[model samples]
Target chain A: MTDASLNTASTQTGEAGFGDYFALLKPRVMTLVVFTALVGLLAAPVSVHPVVGFAAILFIAVGGGASGALNMWWDADIDAVMKRTARRPIPSGKVTGDEAFAIGMTLSAFAVVFLALATNWVAAGLLAFTIFFYVVIYSMWLKRWTPQNIVIGGAAGAFPPMIGWAAATGTVSIESVLMFALIFMWTPPHFWALALFMRSDYDEAGVPMLTVTHGRRATRVHILVYTILLAALAIGTGFTAVGGPIYLAVAVVLNVMFLIGAVRIWRRDEVMSEADNYAVEKKVFRLSLYYLFAHFGAIALEAGLAPFGFGGW
Target chain B: MSFRQEHELHKRRFGRNLGLGVILAGLVALVFGLTVVKVSNDDFSVETQASGGQN
Candidate 1:
């Protein structure tokens, strides 16, 4: 380990800034959590007051950030080893593990209690469960233990929309369950693609990613299988209440493009050079980002148009 | 930076974090206050009843 990695709460380097603390929140991931949660709230059958909706999304975002902070604290050692995550606040020596832990615990308590006050106990309960699953179940246990880590841990990411739905309706329904399933199915192909390109990072970090544990060929096959399953689920979701002409159109086009990318990835030979190998994987990873955003956007559009009788046949 | 300067910087950052905590606490208080007000108000109850009846 380098000196940077050795530095922790005992060592005093540069003073941490607000931005450093914010970085501990994993703002990029929080953005997805907030967006999906918003879609779930908006797309629900029940109508929530604008204030209530705003408050719920805010608390959900905070809860997601709290999870990120706790995950960073727990995984700082592995994070220091991974090139992709080396610059994170804790790993980079910008913040201490103790600071990250304190911030995470404080925010976790704040987000859960306030969410219960702002919305309902059901939503609060889901938020609390998401934090526990991410911090303890995924970060502490499954990540180091199994190659199927993301497969089970994906549930942590999948619960935001369900929490949002519960916040609005105070109940879980088929629509919210489908929303959860959509993300749950999409996560494997998404992360595995990144893992394929960044295999060395996981290897160095000693993370039991599928690519490290199962070999590239098996990972490729898994990606293809999961992508096909995801396509089926995504397209099937379009016929539900969350779907309409807009959502269905988006789903059909995106899933076809996604499947083609997955197939191209699966067909590539292991002997191919790094640049050529990564190009297809990178394209799939980029497409996966748009695939999610566009689907959620279409759902939001359907919800917006529902009152005009242009939504869900 | 000198040792004294670094110590001042640490103090400032601590103050900023404290400010952030206070602000967040205030937001929590505001949300709780609004929920209390809504619960006590007849208008909110009527709105809830209207929406419930529609359902």
Candidate 2:
């Protein structure tokens, strides 16, 4: 490398600062976690005390931030290698890897302990496990070793709503499981779509993405399969206790459109991929964003209707 | 006071506002109040007071 020295910038050049450390938490992703977790708390059958609910969500957000920090800590090497990720907090010398690790561990402990104190032990335990799953299992293990990293690692992001539910209700339920299932199903297609267009990213980063490990053709098919399954699961959730006619109807229409998009991707030619560049892949990525917001919005709507006693399966 | 005291006061003015707690609480209350008001106007005459159920 001539592009930029891959050495830790924090020590050599001293780029690490307050903002850089904050950025390591991936606040954009944390915003999504907070919003979804709030929806889960609102939709839950149980009502947590206001302070308790606030504390639970706050701790959950911190846990999410902790995961992001640990992810940066571990992926520093790859971040230095990849163009898109070259300027990340750790790789750009904006933050030291050791500092990131320390921050992640501290936040992780604080989140789990405070969540347990504010909510219930069960929710706290789940939050702890979620952090471990993301930092230890996904960042440390699956991400470098296998192409299915996103598939399994996606579990970390999926647990927020379930934890929010448990925080409210003190236990797991079919509805929470379904919420988990919806996010779990969406992860594969969402990330694979990015991988398809950004294949060179994985090549340069040396990340074993499905597109890199198995070829773009295989990754495209897998995205289609997972999208279909996600659609099915999304629609099925509407029939559950947490769902209602509104959610069901919305799920059906959204899933149908999602499936159509997946099929379009699958049928396209790879030779054509180089020509169209990011069109198809970008479409898939944009659709995946809509897919998540729509599902959660429908859930929130169903809950809104419930106060009227006019919505349910 | 030493230089650190003056600097701390100046920084607090510019650093991330710590008053978000009340702001967030106010927002939540506004939304909850709006929901109650909307429901009251609607036909939800089930006398649903405060929540006390499980899913």
Candidate 3:
């Protein structure tokens, strides 16, 4: 380290600002949580009081954030080794792991209690289970042990909409389940595509990602298979109660694009990928983000237009 | 001397305090709003309305 760098590090070590603490929440992940949950709430048959709806989404987001903090705390060791996560609060020494744990526990409890008060016990119960599944079942147990980690752990991310539906209607239904299925199936291909390009980070971090354990060829095939399955699910959802003409059109266009991308990924070898810096993988990863957002956005749009008699069939 | 040379540490501390203050204020407003909405809800007043003829 340079003298200037060392001096800066020394001065800033353990001197966390509010942003550092916020970073512990993994705000990017929370965005997906908040959006899905909002879509679920809006699409429900029952109308929620506006304040209660807002509070439900907020507490759900806080619960998601709390789980992220706990994941960072537990994964700090591997995070330090991975280039993608090396600059996280705990790994970078901006925040200690213990502090992260405390914040996570505190926020988790606060979110659950407040969500129950704002909506109902069913929503609160699902929120509490989501945090436990993400932190304990996924982060602590499955992540390091199996290449199937993302496949199962993805369920944790998929629960927000279900919880939101429960919050608004005080019950779970076929519509919410279909929404959950959409996200659940989309995650594997989305993450595996990322693993294709970020090849060394997971390897170095010793995580049993599909790319690291089953090899790149298998990972590619897995992506293709999952994308095909995901396409079927996404398109089929368009026929569900939560779906409509707008959602069907959006799903058709996006799924075709996603399938073509998956086929390209499956056809390319590592040599071809490396020759062009994994262009197809990178493109697919970018498309995955848009794919999910567009799908959910379409669902929300369908719900929004329903009152005007233009949303659903 | 009175200023004590105002370091980066103090600025960060101030920011943390300010952020906490805003979050607490937001929580208070949210709770108050929820109370008003819940109290004024038709469900909450249903019991009062049902007893009015009997009393």
Q: Estimate each model's TM-score.
A: 0.89, 0.83, 0.96
Q: List the candidates ranked by lDDT, beginning with the highest.
A: 3, 1, 2
**Superposition-based RMSD of candidate 2 using all C-alpha atoms, in angstroms:** 7.4
Off by over 4 Å in 2: A1-15, B1-55
Candidates 1 and 2 compared: the better one by TM-score is 1
Q: For residues A1-313, what per-residue lDDT tens digits would candidate 2 score against the true structure?
A: 4333544433343534456767888998898788778778878988666766787888899899998999999998888777777778877775678989999998899888878866789899999999999989999999999999999999999999999998888898888888888888899999998888877778877789998889888988998999888887888788888888888888888888888888888998678877888688788799888878888888888887887887775
Error of 3 at A96 (Å): 0.5
lDDT of each: 0.90, 0.81, 0.94
Q: Which ten residues in a row have the lowest lDDT in candidate 3 chain A?
A: A2-11
| Model 2 / residue A97 / CA error / Å | 1.1
What DockQ does each prediction reach against the true complex?
0.27, 0.05, 0.88
lDDT of 3 by residue, A91-166 (tens): 7789988999999999999999999999999999999999999999999999999999999999999999999999
Candidate 1, A128-201: lDDT as tens digits:
99999999999999999999999999999999999999999999999999999999999999999999888688
True contacts kept of 2: 0.00
Task: Tell me the number of clashing residue pairs for each predicted model.
Answer: 0, 2, 0
Q: Model 3: runs farther than 4 Å from truth?
A: A1-12, B1-3, B51-54
lDDT of 2 at A254: 81
